[model samples]
Target: MELPKDPAMLLSIVNMKLRDFYPTLTTLCEEMEIKETELTERLASIGYEYDADGNQFV
Candidate 1:
């Protein structure tokens, strides 16, 4: 499915997937066919960065 265009929604959805499904952002991106760079840049637009230890954006 296509991702939410809204940044807040994107953050929520990505975080949820990260928390429940993926072990790492790289895995998520590869399996889900999302570009890691774009995902990071999108979240970074709203001041969220991936925290690898927690596997979530903060």
Candidate 2:
């Protein structure tokens, strides 16, 4: 699936999915058909990174 083009929106969507659905970034990427590196890179551009312990991008 195509994610939001805007980083902030992407952060919100991904974080929500993380909070409500996925157990890990890896799981989310696999089930959602997203690239781990690409998602991290996009969110990193906005100064957010995945905290595996918290299971969210903070």
For candidate 1, which ten residues in a row score worst on lDDT? 1-10
**TM-score per candidate:** 0.97, 0.95
* Candidate 2, run of 10 with poorest lDDT: 1-10
Q: Count clashing residue pairs in model 2.
A: 0
Candidate 1: C-alpha lDDT: 0.96
Q: Count residue pairs with overlapping backbones in model 1.
A: 0
lDDT of each: 0.96, 0.94
Q: Per-residue lDDT for 1-58 in model 1, tens only?
A: 7999999999999999999999999999998999999999999999999999999999
On residues 15-47, what C-alpha lDDT tens digit does candidate 2 reach at each position?
Answer: 999999999999999999878999999999989
Give candidate 1's error at residue 13 in angstroms: 0.2
lDDT of 1 at 24: 99
Q: Give candidates' CA RMSD values in order.
A: 0.5, 0.7
Candidate 1 residue spans exceeding 4 A from truth:
none
